[model samples]
Target: MVDVLEAGGWGLLAGSALLLGAVLGYTLRIPHQVVASVMAFGAGVLLSAVSFELALEAYDRSGMLPLVLGTVAGAAAYTAGNVLLARRGARHRKRSGQVRGRSQPSEGQQAGSGLALALGALLDGVPESAVIGLGTAEGGAVSAVTVAAVFISNVPEGLSSSAGMRGAGRGKGYVFGLWGSIAAASMVAAAVGSAVAGALPASAVAAVTAVAAGAILTMVADTMIPEAFEEAHQAVGLIVVAGFLVSFALSRA
Candidate 1:
């Protein structure tokens, strides 16, 4: 119980990025290029975490078959969920703020619903938070780099998404409340992950981890990179490389 609580606390700490980003979006008029650059950098950090921390670990433990299957399922799950949300008017779930002001009013309504941001945050955050707990289950501290990667990635997610939603007419209170709930959910996921770590077999761990990797990779490829390029243009590639190298170095440390 204590361990679970500790994991939950850490998850809360990490999840705070969402609220922080939302605050920035609500309070500041961030430039378009800055949003794009940050998104690109966050994508790079997330890529490193997925590649080295989640994908490699899953491959090592569960072999290729399980990892592949899990990856497929994870991607499918996120894609389906995104499609459903898009249909419901949250098409800007992963969109950068620069282009979002052009949406129709009805589309704004959907964005204001806040469901898209919440779901998107969960799709990305839960898995990483679970990994934190999984580390604790191994009788060790959570990887500092993993936390950094997740936290940093989440900031852009919150910032960009919040900007879009705010442009769509969502209230500051609504955005703050949405990110706050996400933070709480993250805490729950972390605690539950660690609590169940002892019961889950290594195969289960690997498959789940692979699921996260797949989902994150799909999200980055499908949404993040595209959005970054849309705004940041050529410089995003270098920033991506820089972000990846930095996260990679942290992982190595």
Candidate 2:
């Protein structure tokens, strides 16, 4: 119970950033370039965390087979889901509705886009939070690198997605409610991940961690990097490298 609570606490702490970003997006007039830079930085953070913290740890725990299979499976799953969501009008979920060069969806598309956006957020967030629980299942301290990466990355995701929802004519109620629910779900995912991992064998735990790493890697490539490059362009590369170095330092520390 203590472990579960601890994991949930950490999960909530990270997930809270989404709500913060949502509020900022709705209330502020932040520039696209700034959002893009931050998004790129966050993506780099996540990349480093996935490589050194999650995937490396998983490799050290079990052998190559579990790590490779799990990663491939995770990436495949996320790709399939993303394709479905895209077909349903959530392809620009990470955009500000105007940043991607695509026109705003018509009224008919707006009605269903909100639901797709909510689901897309869930698909992106749940696996990341689950790994937090995996980190604590051994009764050790949760990985600070993973927690920080998730929190930092989620801020831009929430901000950009909320901005897109707003531009799509979504109401404040729907936008906030969607993020709030997803945050709550993140807490639950972390707790459940901890509980489940505690009962699994070491190989299984490693596979699960690898799975999360793969999903996160795919997400960063598919959604985040493109959006960042859309606005920040050449500067995003430097910002990403800086973010990666910071996360790598945290992992070492």
Kindly list the per-residue Cα lDDT of model 1 for residues 35-139, writing each as its tens digit: 889889988988998899888988998799889988998899889877876776665443432254574445455474346766788877898788888877676
- Give the clash count for each candidate: 0, 0
In angstroms, give how far residue 53 of model 1 lies from its true place.
0.6
Model 1 poorest 10 in a row by lDDT: 91-100
What does candidate 2's lDDT look like per residue over 1-253, in tens digits? 8999888888888888888888887778789889999999999998999999888988999989999988998899888988887788765444434545677566545535556656766876788788898888775789999999999998877786676667677899988988998999899889898888867888988888888888889988987898789889979999999899999999899
* Candidate 1 all-Cα RMSD: 2.5
lDDT for 104 in candidate 1 is: 40
TM-score of each: 0.90, 0.92
